[model samples]
Target: MKNSRGSLVRPHPLPESASRPVVTPLSPSVVYASDTPDALDAQYEGRVHGYTYSREGHPNADVVAARLDGMEGVAGGVVTGSGMAAVSAVLLGLLKAGDHVIGGNQLYGRSLRMMKEDLPRLDIATSLADPGDVKAVEAAIRPETKLILVEAVSNPTLRVADIDGLAKLAKDRGILLAVDNTFTTPRAFRPFEHGADIVIHSITKLLAGHSDVMLGWVAAKDPALAQRLRVFSVTAGLTASPFDCWLAERGMLTFDLRFERAQATAAALADHLATLPGVKRVIYPMRADHPDHTRAAALLQGQGCNMVSFELKGGREAANAFTRAAEGLSFAPTLGDVGTTLSHPASSSHRALTPEERAALGLSEGFFRVSVGLEEPKALLAIFAEAVAAAVPGA
Candidate 1:
């Protein structure tokens, strides 16, 4: 006979059934039980299929990774705690001291910071180049360069990279090209199909299609490279929680529908903003006036993403007033939500850069980014038009 406390702690296991649940069951256990020491050793040695620790690997993360792999059409992938974790896992996992990295100047600010600030601390060298300019990237590469990193579509600025050109250059130089496809997602672009060695994503964005989860993933065209990244992620303890993974997977079910709705709204908004009184410029990949319009058309197949950025003639004051007057919009620092939101790049995304650096990137005081959402186009257009009038008064 067992004591009450012992009996309570050791609950009876559920009976096995042939029928399976329609939805995948969420497994939140951090540690798993093994039949014996030999079985545990076999699992640890990779001779058997099982999870021992959540930090190394788990069922939820595996399922999500598999789905991402299918979407990217890659050999394999791994999920991490955050987008930055995926970035760090790739950079820190593959490169060692004395190696060099050539990265795009217009990447997400934190990624740029990691290259310029963090990599240097570890004795690794980094150089910045305009990813849209393939010749400039090639010029920046050195004999020791092991990696070339760029975003499929740059943050806030919306500079589209020449992925094919960059991939060819990297391959000829024996360097790996890592493309961050967070902004574009797989629906807009697939890096692997175009010769990229690695593809990264901030799954918190359009892939998840909601702002509920903070998760990211990295996929590799080569199985060996994917294994390397997975090992490094485990060692660094960058694995995502089961709950986050589950939430992200759920969000992915509606990704295509959500993305299509947001993209349509963004396109209409871009055209409307360009004709407004106080608007100075609109930056959208599909716009003919965009710097990378031709390349974006070819790569994205005329399907631009949901992100839209514009500059106001009144700069900071006008931006502040617009946010205050905008009826249905929220002033959020992050992006990819169901509700339309505005973000100030100068104060939010690109604040890490020095004033001079930010000016060079064309992120001025009036610059604002819009994450279009599932909203009625007419209502949003009216709201923005009224706010613009209120902000720049009589312009």
Candidate 2:
């Protein structure tokens, strides 16, 4: 977040009350570049390294990219216009016509759709598998398998994948391991430290907690691979505006503060919602009742993320009713905003997936996604509880 003027007064909104605020120490003139630099010579322009143009490298974008690389502990990083841009750049850079990609079936709908529909158009073959089923991952890999991609914490349903195990598998098969850390961000998980070759994030989500920016970042352990990503990013013109990068950086600085409260809210709401009527199932990764709680505990040692998804007993109609009844809840398909966001899986984020596809991934019509924010845990819960009570009869 080069040139990011983070909140001078970093407000820590508490569940109970507001605390004394601390301000960030950065104020760069974050202006979008007029010239979209294409060539290396033009992008570098005898700068610190070789950044000649705005498209390839601008001081502002490069500064933010460096911050991301440092945060993720990777060799290099590339920033893009959006998370999908980063995904596309990595795929275009790493995969070729005959290359095989073994992907997780339970992914952000756009991600899955990208592999299923977009990759084939480029003549790349993909094998979708249940990431929760480790055996399927091993079984799906072919000799041509060049990449094994999975979300660190999946969208809609917050299922934690065995990243270290998958990274080892990719190492054994000489395939790249790319983990999408959009939900968890670096505050909760560091994929490279866990043996992943590459880590990608939709900064617009959790990292840019304010939901005002549309940016993406990809960090790689291998410098060679990072260079390839840079090449693809420049060629594809997947450049993030400096203003967006600055805004995203502003959000990143407060990530620790925001998530601390959000995580607590998620936990409290998880417990509260489980007892409420029409809430048949709850999926909070850190909860003891969660099937994958042990692994989540092992991986996310201290920092717990704020995403929680649950099944409403009343199904789609209930889901729609609850969402429509939301007064304080921000009814958006996006997540990780400072404002609490409620997403309906059947019609929102996973709408791109067909009924069969969603069912195979265990995404039912009753599924509701919640991104816990700085809102008071009780207030958010009460908002949802009232919605649930209205959606389902009795209590």
Candidate 3:
């Protein structure tokens, strides 16, 4: 290695036979090589073609980023190590000390905690408002407010946000509206179409659709913001691993089919759960009883989310019993798996919140969220029915 410039100087060529196949699956590579000194210099100088380092950029990451951008119809995007990484990159890259951010009260618990606790530590103030109440959200916005953070569909409860309304609110105030569209994958609801300034996704969920990868992405309607995010991602060391990006890209091939099937199952299961005596309430975007039904219908593009939530009359005890009885389904803390899984919010996702805080968000001891999977609907229904009966024999 005897280069004054930053270009990688290989001692010798990679050992290989002269003959090689023309077609091959693209593999994850951390570093690219070139034989010519001038070409290598050009690459190091930012004039030539390939990735010089893994942290800055890679081919696998580029493919995933481009596909995500295409899905959302956004200008550009970047992949990150995790969903929180994506969220943090956008907030830290775009916002600074003294900036004001408006966040939704019904956001994912970790996101809420970050805005409420971490942002204040950095002198970036945040106001939590229910996006469902447009007037309340508008009231909370201040002159210094620069961003509105919300979820396309809230976690655990499946409360769909009025993205179009929030988009208008952000536009009128000249602020950025960032929606975490993890619940409704871009195929189900393109946030850009509804005028969202930024669209974020926890690709670990439905996009991956198999629970094998951990990755996230942020796409921006504004190219400048996307560029900033890319730089921030690299410097912050939050860029997704090349292998994860490659795996997620492969998952995207069947995402449309998986999401369609899963959501249909969710809708059917929601209706069935509503009929169960043990379930006090069922929440799904397609249900008429859901408060956000009309709004979700308008925004969901006729495909409901791959989640169904319900409240059991007997509280946490019954939830535990049901999970024990549900032999075929996984009792996992996470969601968006190909195999259906159940999670208890009171004990898992929203466990950090106080009882009052949980209650305010309509989360109680008996509340459970079911992530519908790509399985036979009848088989899933039978397993759930058996579990409910075992949990509440009389009811």
Please tell me which predicted candidate would have the highest TM-score against the true structure. 1
> Which is the better candidate, 1 or 3, if ranked by lDDT?
1
Which regions of candidate 1 deviate over 4 angstroms?
1-8
Q: CA lDDT, every prediction?
A: 0.92, 0.82, 0.87
Off by over 4 Å in 3: 1-28, 34-46
> Model 1: what TM-score?
0.97
Cα lDDT tens digits, model 1, 88-192, are: 988999999999999999989899899989999999999999999999999998999999999999998999999999999999999999999998999899999
C-alpha RMSD of candidate 1: 1.5
Cα misplacement distance, residue 74 of candidate 3 (Å): 1.8
Predicted structure with the largest lDDT when compared to the true one: 1
- Ordered list by lDDT, greatest first: 1, 3, 2
lDDT of 2 at 380: 82
Clashes of 1: 0
What digit string (tens of lDDT, one per residue) describes model 2 on residues 1-395? 54445564633432563664353323243333333444444535544354434676666567678888888887569889999998888788899999999888788888888898999999999998867667889999988999988998888777889887888888887989999998888888999888899889898888788889999998788888888998899888998887887787777878788888988888888888899878889998988888778888998885558988888887788877887887878888888888898887778778888899788767888888888889877778789888888877674
TM-score for each candidate, following the candidate numbering? 0.97, 0.88, 0.92
